[model samples]
Target chain A: MVHKALKIARVMLSVYYAYMVEYRAELVFWVLSGTFPLILMGLWVEAAQGDRFDLTPTELVQYFLAVFLVRQFTVVWVIWEFEREVVEGRLSSYLLQPVDPAWRHFFSHVSERFARLPFAFLLVGLFLLLYPYAAWLPRLDNLLLGLLATVLAFCLRFLMQYTFALAAFWIERASALEQFWFLPYTFLSGMVAPLALFPDAVRAAVLWTPFPYLIYFPASLLINRPDHVAQGFAAMVLWSALFWGLNRWLWRQGLRQYSGMGA
Target chain B: MERYLKVLRLFWGTAIAAELEYRLNFIITALISLGGLVGSLFGLFLFYRTGYQFAGWSWEEALLVLGLFTVLQGFSTTLLIPNLNKIVTQVQQGTLDFVLLKPISSQFWLSTRVISPWGLPDVLFGLVMIGYSGDRLGLTWADYGLALLPLTFGAITLYSLWFMLGATSIWFVKIYNVTEVLRGLLEAGRFPIAAYPAAYRVFFTFVVPVAFLTTVPAQTMLHQGGRGWLLASGLLAIVLALLANRFWRFALRFYTSASS
Candidate 1:
């Protein structure tokens, strides 16, 4: 059964990859649309001129570049898709399928990464060429661990958003709820700034949340700071499991409610 | 002009009534807007904590720029974005034919058909923020009056840019993603244009005109610059509006109904 599922996943990945390629221009635009990190990078780089944040200007550039790369990997749009499907009664079709619908969404997102990789590499190359001073080579061990952490981060983010999307079963404003979640995520996940740059108390509180494991931990690893690698990985696994369980419970309840309405 | 105002009034009244039927949406929208405001403030707090001057603007001046950004965002999201997004779907499903067939001007009708009144809270919040920041900066009524001309021109410029983007959907139905690019670039407007690198400042000023959208108004209110930018903004708006009108006519010539 595991082998069969793996094979099915491969097939779905390839199919979705082809679909993404067909819409390659739109995909490029989507990728280019994540310029917020670069904007913050500019601000921080200028701020670093006074050498106040303990990070050199080059370090600030590297940190934000890492942020931009990790953000592309960990981003999830399942809430939007799932909300639309549930609200439009399209999930009923998915329910009739032999395979679980989550696998389909997972494969679609995974395939998007595959489609986006070449363009991402090109963009990174151009950026490095433009700013040679910002370039830094990470240790091999750090690079490998960062990759692993990024994969886990992606899974954790996808499952958490999917769990949130399950709210559509009861409320039409699930997307608004997602927006509410984004407010905290933006600050806590180190998207706005490095967690270290935040005040001590805020950083301490943010560290307790699962948000940092999604972006900050992986970004830190990529930049060769493996101080909390073990703890971060443990927290990531625990959060992913928690979200998975919650998603399963919500899915079952939502299915019951959905069918009760005769959808 | 009176006829157009009457038509807009009728359309907005019905749209508001239809939207109010979902009373919970107002609460949700208010919450989301509040969240956005808080998030931006938190970011400003972090930036200020590092030091006093951000790209040579004081904390209060920076806050004023953020307020301007919020106002423009609220206006665009409530009126321009939703209406423009509808063009994508209309073009895709051939519903645009109905829009074009109407006796009224299609561009005017398409742009004003829907209004998300729930977004008014963001507008009010932004105005209050501007007032508070302006008062902190010791801005007088004359300063605000000076800012008004440029602010109006900025709004026209933004509307023209968005209208041009929406008109492009007639040729490329999937151009909705271009709006995402516009939104991404708009994030830069949260800061003063001078905060960015010189190269980025040029790009935002000329290519996207984000500087006109937020920076100019804030500067005028702060009494930092003279009326030259205001006149430039008005001229740019007229030129862009004419160009957008031309493009809309050109795109209409290529419209093939999906039903056919």
Candidate 2:
């Protein structure tokens, strides 16, 4: 079992390195894409106007800066990867591999996020230095919970997105499907604005959905008050389990369809 | 002009036929798109409920901006998406050579290669929203025309900028995130430019051009300004388009295909 696991890990790691080498320039370009968030940060800061919002202007600044950092830390690019592989017949290469293709893809996906950390941290430090308020925003306990929540959030997001991609097995032109999934998540995932800032009904609705656990939970852990962290963490673990089970069921059904082609 | 129209007609016809092969997909996808539109509006509605106006513009104005944004996005997806998506393969595999050898302008042909007819739904929806907003905001026809002209110009500027970025794929070969960055930046336009305050208004208007892309155009529809600014922005788009064409030609020289 150890030998098999190590072999799979080694192969996926090599694929990750290969992807980095091939797309190094694209990686740099993506890192530059962080500029938009910074621009939004500046804009939102000025608009807040001396603690005009519920939080102080500095607090607003800290919120967006944390958002930028957490987003960079947790962003996933697998939806496109899965869609492309299926659409372009590239899944054949993965199918030939001895280990499960989804597992290999997940490892590589995690590696990409890991590889991006140095740059994400650099930006976080810059934000911290420029806006000292952000550095003091998170308590140690919440920070720890945030980190743990981020891991679960990543797993839940991966499961949900993988299921969405698996739907491509049965559908053609999956871009619309991908877009449909992404657009709502953009709002509910707390990428647009805080769920707390959302109307009470909207906030309740988002909380009930799995989307907030993807990004909002980690972001809220950092930005929200200390009292809110434990609740957010509990919510995350619950959603993670729900999505994981859903993903497992979908994968099993999808595999059945694949094997039944011969039957 | 007639030739261009004919080209558009033929391409759009082919695209619709191709897309219609999966007709249920159109309904499902459109329904999904409607869900997204509703979600966006839900966010906007929540913001409005808290206060009468955000920054300076009212809900009606914000909707207009969103409508313009959706229309431009539809235009890009319908016209440029299919073509620009192939840039990586064209460069990596050297299949761009086939495109270059074609009788028409390589840049034009390559840029307009595939059209997604379904994208028209977004454009239609955008027009409807703009009309509804104009009526609610008490905008006159002259004001609407003024706004439409600049928005048309802004849309062209957006297309030109995308063309330049897409052309960069000839050299970089893997800048898929370029479009994503554009999309992300454009998302800021969902709210009024005033919502962001002064520096952001400047950033959106001058630097990233997001204001011209949506907010300013939407504002013009509400009679925020006469046609002068819109005309100037339109002229700016023409110049940008010229520059993009020049860059496209320059990038072509660097296109050593992976396939070759």
Candidate 3:
């Protein structure tokens, strides 16, 4: 049974590999999307120059660079993909297979990350060599932990966003809701800046939210050993369980709706 | 001139009629737009809390920049973006043949195809913010009017550049990625150009030309920064438009209709 599941995962990976090859230009385009975060890093580093915050300028550089790395690895297309499949009735295609649809989707998500690894590695090396402060980056073990946390965070985010996307099956309009969910995540996820930079009240609010676990915690884990990696990972695991439950519930409900078993 | 006015009038009427058909959607979109404006203003407010001045500009001056950026962004949403954004799908699906077959200029048709009149609220909100900020900053009406002149030219330049980006779909089958790049570049407009370092300032002023779009307008109004920079931007716009027009023509030549 384990072997069969591994085979299924392999097949899913091959399919995504084929898709990526077929859309090679898109892969290049997606890599270029990393440029925006790098630009943000540039602006922040300049702002931090000769100015002391709680962290040094080099520390800020390491922080954002780590963010760029983790963000690329933790990316998922599940929200948009889930919406498209559900709306277009393509979920039926997935239902025909013996494997769980969510599992297949998650497998595809991981496969895409693997595909991005080449460019992601190249960017990391380039950033370290080219940027002013390469020495400030965390050690290799911390880097591995950062990678693990980021993977868990990606799974958590996927479950949450995919659950949100399943609302398309119920609502006539889900785009606004999807946008609402995403726009706040940009601020809250520490994509634009560290949650620490936020006002204390706002930072406190964000701590309980799932957003920080997505980008900030993993980033901080890699850049500097904050006093909170263990705590944040615990939070991420808890949220992951909750979101997984919510996703299972929603998927079951969505499937019933699809099967005309719901009012 | 009369023909152009007639086209504008016709497009305006159709847009209004289309908007009125789904008043609920219009209302929702308008409210969302207002929400977006508030979010943008709040972002500016956050930046202000950090310091009295950023990169040599006062907080109120920065507010003017935000207000002007909002206006330009509104203009895009209201006029150019909705219509042009669909160009890729239309081209890919072979529906652009209908557009090309029209008696009017294809550029004119595609550019003015869909104006989201509901987006006018953003314009109003932006103007209100600009007016209020100017009052608080003690800037006179003359400054605002003088600023408007260059900005008018800047707006046209920007619209033309964006249309050119959309027009590239005729050649490159997957120009959506290119459009995504532009969207990414638009984030650069969120902060004042001066706040950014020299590298970014040059890049925005020259490469992306966002400086011409937002900062120049705000600078003119708040600081009365001379027309020298504005004229240079205008000249750059003219060059870019001319090149874009040529590129458009080149792409048109490669267009074998995807239709059967």
Candidate 4:
């Protein structure tokens, strides 16, 4: 059974990767669109040059570079995809398929990430070349941990957004809800700034929430701050399980509701 | 001119009434707009907490720039983006033929066919922010008066840029990603252009010209940009409008009817 599932996953990944390559322009745009972190990096680096923040300019650069890298991995678009399918009645086709619809979304997103990886690497390489001052030597252990944390972070974000997308079952405005969720996520996820730069009260409050575990904790690992690694992993696992439960509940309810509506 | 006004009134009246049918969307959009405003302000607050001026602009000045950015963003969302999106879809679905068949200029009709009244809350919120920031700066009435000229030109420039992008759908049916690219670039306008590095400053000013969208207007209001800059902005708007119009015509020539 496990072997069959692995074979299916392999075929799905290859198919989606081939399909994703057709939109090379869009793939490039997606990579460029994720450069907001670099913009914030520029601002913080300039400020740090004035010795205002406790962070040195080089530290600010490394932190935001890590942020840019982590952001590329943690991106999610399943909310939009699910919303479109549900609204347009395309979900019916997926419902009839033998495989779960969510797996298709997962495979497609993973493949797109693979397609986007080279562009992201090229951009990062160019950025580092242009700003060599931003270079840093991360410890090998921390680097490995950062990669692990990043994988977990990506899974957490994707599942969370997929759960949010399930709201489409009840409302036509699920995307709006997604936007509402996005606002807080932007601040809490350390996309705007390192959570450490936030006031102590805000940082403490955010750490308790699952948002920081999605981006900040992983990013902090790369910067050699592993003090919270164990706790971060614990929060990640707890939140993932909770979201997984919520997703199953919502999917069952939504499917019933959808079929009742004659879809 | 009177005929265009009548047509616009009729178009907006029906469009708004059609949108009102989705009552829940109104509340959702209002909340989303509010969320966006709060998110931008929170970002500014974080920078302010650092207690250092960004690009020589204090927190108050930076807030004004953000307000102007929000106002222009609200305008684009309210009047421009939805219409452009509709045109792109029409082009894709071969429904643009009906638009071209209309007696009115297709450009004008396509540009004015939709107005999202639900976006008004963002405009109101942005105006309130601008007023508050202006009060803090103690701007004279004349400063506000001068700011209006550049703001009008900026709106024209942005509209032309969007129209040009929409027109390109004639050739590239899936130009939605280009629109997304523009949206991403516009995010930079939330801060003063000076806050960016020299390379980015040049790119945003001359290449994309997002600086005119917000930064110049805010600077003009604060008595920062001299009249020379204002004149240059006006010239750029006219030049861009003409260039966009020409590009639209050029694309139209290549547009073999999607239906056929």
Best by TM-score: 1
Model 1 C-alpha lDDT per residue in residues B107-186, reported as the tens digit of each score? 89998999988768788888889999999888999988988888888888898888888888887788878888788988
Question: Total clashes, candidate 3?
Answer: 0
Of 1 and 4, the candidate ahead on TM-score is 1
- Write down the C-alpha DockQ for each prediction: 0.75, 0.45, 0.42, 0.65
Interface RMSD of 2: 3.1
lDDT of 4 at B245: 77
Model 2: per-residue lDDT, tens digit, A73-157?
6667677887777767677666877777888778887777767777777777877787775566577877887777778777777
Model 4: residues >4 Å from true position, as ranges? A260-263
**Local error of candidate 3 at A160, Å?**
1.2
lDDT (tens digit, per residue) of candidate 4 on A224-262: 867578889999999999999999999998998884233
Query: Taking chain A of candidate 4, what TM-score results?
Result: 0.96
In model 2, pairs of residues that clash are B93-B259, B94-B257
TM-score of each: 0.97, 0.89, 0.91, 0.96
Clashing pairs in 1: none
> How is the predicted docking of candidate 1 categorized under the CAPRI scheme?
medium
Per-residue lDDT of model 3, residues B45-87, tens digit only: 5445566356767777777777787777778888877887888
lDDT of 3 by residue, A124-229 (tens): 7877787645557467888788888888888887888787877877864556566666666776677766766677888888899888888889888888656487
What C-alpha lDDT values do all the predictions have?
Answer: 0.86, 0.73, 0.75, 0.86
Which 10-residue window in model 4 chain A sums to the lowest lDDT? Answer: A254-263
lDDT (Cα, 0-100) at B176 in candidate 4: 79
Reference-based lDDT, residue B67, model 1? 89
User: Candidate 3, which segments miss by more than 4 Å at Cα?
Assistant: A50-52, A124-130, A135-137, A259-263, B19-47
